[model samples]
Target: MNEYLTSLDRPIEAVRYAGLTVKLLSTGDGTEVIHHTLQEGSRWSMQPQEGWTASESIFITSGSLKVTVDEETKVLSTGDVVSASPIKQGLVFLALEETEFIYISSQPVFQFFSEIVRKNQELAIEVALKDGYTAEHCKRIMQMSMLIGERMELSPGDMCTLNYASYLHDVGKIMIPKSILLKEGPLSEEEWEEMKRHCTYGKELLEATDSPYMRASGTIVEQHHERFDGKGYPNGLQRDEISPLAYIVSVVDAFDAMTTDRPYRKAMSVENAIEELNENAGTMFHPEVVKIFIDLIPEWSKMKQGV
Candidate 1:
């Protein structure tokens, strides 16, 4: 008996791994067809999987890319084709433009993406932690952001964007000077201005990947610092000018930061965190998101205490 599934049963889900956006177009039958997109200047470095024998051919659909194998670089333009499988040693690709391609493999593949995304997220967290943010700050923000998104009934795409944006909202801190990022006291006016540049830096970093999820995430990251009352940084985007996902993240991010230890101060009590969030809801965050998160606080505290 032959088994087949409809598109509804096997929907196409895009996966952003490292710098490449991948979609499994077809699978099984001992073969795999993947659609990929890489933005200009993005680099993808893949090491060979042990004992892997998946031989795949890459066909460029549009734009251009430079493939380097064993230190020899070759540029592939639109309509170009190349056979490179099992990801040979020292194989790397740099997108010269917004490149798209199709990869047909003689063997079914995947699974490696989980590890790749995990490691990348860990690296991002490590980079953020180096600046004195709590280890679990981003993780908490991401969890609450997802829950708030669900409560607000966000669309599937918006939920995905929220996940990435909330987790990486502070990733631009990597660009801030250690002196400013790690200061024990409040930032001076000039230093505060410099600190605000992180929003722009984060957007640039993630937007360069060109993946749909990351690009949307970049927009959210850029606006996550924006206040609802037009008092935010980088831009004074107010009210509806802000991305809804960013508003969700802003509430969650502020709550997490308030409730977590920092280089300059100790963590606030749960009661104080709640009060702070409520106090600034209209000015610093979206009223609805803040309300949703505030409602979730007691439930979250119970979970934390294993009650």
Candidate 2:
């Protein structure tokens, strides 16, 4: 094997989160060096797993960073170095501006992070297969959510959260009984209550990963059912109390659900779905999101028609 590798060499692994890219630069002798590029306004947080005690060191190579270790926070520019104490409570790194840094830590720690991303990907596939509509519905929701997110000019971090949350929002449905999920008639009141538990299940599912991105995504999963008028379930959180990403997911998910065939009903026409959304605007859905989504329907239809 070659003793040295160049930038052209393929990364051992790479992952993107919250507008940041993490690349495994090198690993050997129980240590790994990871390169991180954080887009301006991006932030990453790490909380040590129980019994974790290895320290990690970071060196900034470009741009500016705001780093918090325990109770202390510091701003660092190019060429600055900071070392985190042995794995303890919250350690946060934020890019005040676009920043590049190298982090050195035990290879096992890096491996753990890599494994979590891989597991999440695998679980997503499993969740998508639990029902026929889930895969297609999630895909459409992701696309529509991105369109609305672009229209809203969301920040990069927000877009990242929105992207992941849209796909994983219904993941908890995997746990629902197949009979209830595929029921062709109206659900019993008891079945409906059981169905509503999916949001909480989804949140718990994502929270197990202990990833900041997953945590953010979990928040959306939990609140996506909330209404603008504060009548929705799980938590009845009112307007603006819900995460903006959750609002986007909620709007897009509803649209996708209306336009897609369900076991209980055929798909609604786009015009009818739009009417339904309009009727519920500001009560069940965010008014601005509803407006933007309604405005985009024409373009979506045009594209579908190959215009």
Q: Where does candidate 1 clash, by residue pair?
A: none
TM-scores for every candidate against the unseen true structure:
0.59, 0.60
TM-score of 2: 0.60
Cα lDDT of model 2 by residue, 177-289, tens digit = 77777666678999999999989988887777634556667889988899999999889998989887888889887877777664446878999999999999999999999
Model 2 scores worst on lDDT over the 10 consecutive residues at 127-136
Worst 10 residues of 1 by lDDT: 111-120
| lDDT of candidate 1 over 1-307, digit per residue (tens) | 1235566466666776434688777777778787888866554433344455667688889998876555466898989987766545534456889899987877654433333354445545554543434435555666677677768966545666676687778777777887886666578999999889999998987766624446567889999889999999889999999998999888877776677665557879989988988899899888888889888887667544535
CA lDDT of 2 in candidate 1?
A: 28
